[model samples]
Target: MRRSLIALSLAIVASTSLTAAARADIKSPVVIATEGAYAPWNLTDSAGKIVGFEPELIDYICKRAKLECTIVAQDWDGMIPGLIAGKSDVIMDAISITPEREQIIAFSNPYARTKAGFLTARDGKFAKADGTGSTLVTTPTLNNAADTLKSLRAKLSGASIGIQTGTVYAEFIEKNFGDIATIREYRTNDERNLDLENGRLDLAFEDTVVLMPTVEKANGALEFTGPAFGGTLFDAGSGFGFRKGDDELKAAFNAGIAAALADGTIKALGEKWLKADVSP
Candidate 1:
């Protein structure tokens, strides 16, 4: 913990002074970044081995692409800047594609799509406004979001929801449920789970796959509710993220991603790790 904090502090302190120099020759053989704290996505297990979905998938893709690459464990916030500062070459984290991010960087074709969902402990009840719905209903495209939001509003009248800061999921909950419930932001899922376990927050909203390994590892302390959500609000999928202007690398990764999808490697890995084929 102390070492990571020191590294994070150093990255921030030296970022501005080193940004231009680091980003100069980013076409190196190795790219690096964090696993983004999603279990089975990217995490260090008990043996201190960096093992997870992205690490394994990227290893396969890099081999297919014939690119010499090295993967490392870094902080999520520093991942982008690490790329910008030439600290790493590729970030295999579960980075989502977004228009805003496009302004600053590029992304390879998506390898996976994990839908959004909310989780509230198996305890708690609240008076309803009308129909008395208690869970988030999957809406591909909510034409009447206001009406549907009332269900969440009714159930969470006085409850609190936890989310990771600076994410689309956080935005979703805030834009829709901010008026109804208190929103608490955590730096990582483990912290948020601690909050959930301790009753500090009533619920959490995030991707189902991102939460999968957590659920499996929990041995039944936490549980999910209702169907997975997607559409315009939740975004389409997760993909390989590249820095801006890195066209060659992005295209190479996209080709590898397409090939993996066709060969069933991605589906097989999804099933092996997550117990479900997340092919969408």
Candidate 2:
């Protein structure tokens, strides 16, 4: 009887230790990478703190998911490569979900939906490019804007356009305008905007929501031109990116994202930060 009791006690202790180990694994710190320079999405304050829409959104997500998350600044170019190399466990920048990117990494359900457009000098020749305020979805087909696309191509022919490197917009611009326009790629949007503002570039293509703040800051110098682009060409929307096999983490984040959407946390935050309804 005494031996049996001792054995039972040992078994209980081992089970408790295993339970604790599993809990520790679940509660371990998750490193989240972001392009901290992307203003209003995730930017570094003058005090070196990462504060913006994404960081705040992730804060709610980490809480709901019971994750201990730490956000760190990463260059836009290295975001995916660094994640795959184990430098970060998650990416929450405004990364669009495209088929090309899905081939490399998995993504959580989209949290925000936005459209891309062109930003040019308000008085420039391309200032009033075709199809302004119209919407175009490039997936499935481009039939909707066949005429508008043609007009834009003709109007911007031989123009200099600036695009950030490693973006879905790069692919779109290259496929459609690459043959006609002089494509200049930059490592950051601020760099690209500098050239555009200084009249070195004829146009800049980016998310209209993201460019809204830039236009506001540009005062009377800049404005959006042409129709907004979306659909599968831009993918569903912006989502949390994860490694190909990080199922557990991805599931946790997806659940949190769903909850945030359902609870209107994402919607409220979008209005607060972006001043637009970006909820996906």
Candidate 3:
């Protein structure tokens, strides 16, 4: 009876040790969410796998940060809510790091910088607008921003403009041009692109990185017009977004992004995918 009791006690100790060991091995992997419809940033391939510039950059970031990560596709409108609800551990959808967004969620250091511009039909009325191909930086705080927006509004007045919902571009349009121009919001950039292609939209505002490739593929059907706006609404550029309290994850990503930027990994990826060096 004594021997049996001793044996049972030993067995229980061993089982407890095994349980602890198993718990130690159970490390959580970071799950990244992105909108697969934003080409050059991210997009679903023919095989239904998410691929693009952001994916490649995130792979490098995860490797540098020693994180096991899985990238998943989510709609643009759901990205922030999904992160807040714990549905995703991170967001790598080229989300601009804007002040308005900062009030809701935290952001890592910017990974890339690009300007926003308008895309219009090649022979459209606004194709030769005064600001075509010019780079303009404006922010709500700038003293001259009101005048600039007034001029821009006049250029786009009475026109139909399409923008992706839940983006800074949408906000910019609503604030500056909504009163004069007809604003159409779509769920995805692809949808907006289709409407623009179908002649349903007079102009479309989007990242120049995204716009350039699309214009190239359009084969003269489309051309970039108006000033390329940066700063302010566009944020300090694009960054990885996390829940407001996830400081540890935010720090890890920021470090990894710094490393990637220092090593030129992001620049190479940006040039390869965006055809420009958009690394911040």
Candidate 4:
């Protein structure tokens, strides 16, 4: 009996040590990066703290995944490079998952989907264009897409269109309307928005989620014009960006995001921030 009792105690000690080791292994923090300039998705407060939809969503995700996480601000252009350089473990910047990007990095299951459209002054010529206030899911082989593009080209011909540099919006414009419209690229959305507001730009192409708040803040000065576009150039919504080989971290984020979407957490957050349900 004495021998059996000693053996049982030894077993208990080993089990406890193993459990502690597992717990320790699970407690390492993940560093997440975001472009703090994108409002409604991720933005910096006056105090320089990151806040907004993506940040709130990530907080819930971390809790659900039991992950210790820290979020850092990064320039939009440097997000991918920083991840490659090991500066961050995840990026939650409303990055659209496109084939071109898929070649370079992995992505979490998409958490939200939105569309791109034009924001112009209320009295702008394009305000009442044929497809205004409608959503268009465009594809390369779609007849309606070709028709819509042709109409938009004619309507916006010779107009100065502003877009942020190095974005899919630039790609779409240059591919479809480059010969028809004068394209101007800015390094930041704020710069393009300023140009649009000052009447230097006849139109500005941007994500509708971002444009909604801008229009509200502009009162009646600005409005979304032309058809809001999705698919193809816009890709299939936004997901968390990860390095190409980080399968473990990608799985963790996917599980957390799936739970959030299942529980309506993402939709609730979207409505609170964007005044729309952008959950995917």
Query: Pick by lDDT: which candidate is best?
Result: 2
Per-residue alpha-carbon lDDT of candidate 3 for residues 107-159, written as tens digits (9 for 90 to 100): 99998988888899999886866677788777656564666666777777899
User: Which ranges in model 3 have alpha carbons more than 4 Å from their true place?
Assistant: 1-27, 145-147
TM-score ranking from best to worst? 2, 4, 3, 1
The per-residue C-alpha lDDT of model 2 at residue 56 equals 87
In the range 62-104, model 4's lDDT, one tens digit per residue, is: 7766677777766677777777777767877788788888887
Worst 10 residues of 1 by lDDT: 12-21
For each candidate, the alpha-carbon lDDT, in order, equals 0.65, 0.78, 0.75, 0.76
Superposing all C-alpha atoms, what RMSD in Å does each candidate have to the true structure? 6.4, 11.8, 12.2, 12.6
Q: Estimate each model's TM-score.
A: 0.82, 0.89, 0.87, 0.88
- Residue 49 displacement (Å), model 1: 2.2
lDDT-sorted candidate list, best first: 2, 4, 3, 1
**lDDT score of model 3?**
0.75
Model 1 clash pairs? 31-89, 31-90, 32-89
**2 or 3, greater by TM-score:** 2
Q: Looking at model 1, how many pairs of residues clash?
A: 3
Question: How would you encode candidate 1's per-residue C-alpha lDDT over 1-280 as one tens digit per residue?
Answer: 0012224333321011111122223354555566445676777776555667777787777777666665567766666666666666666666777776666667777788776676655544532233322333444356645665666577677778888876778877888789878999887778887787676777777877777656666566666654346554555567776777778777777888888899998999888776677665
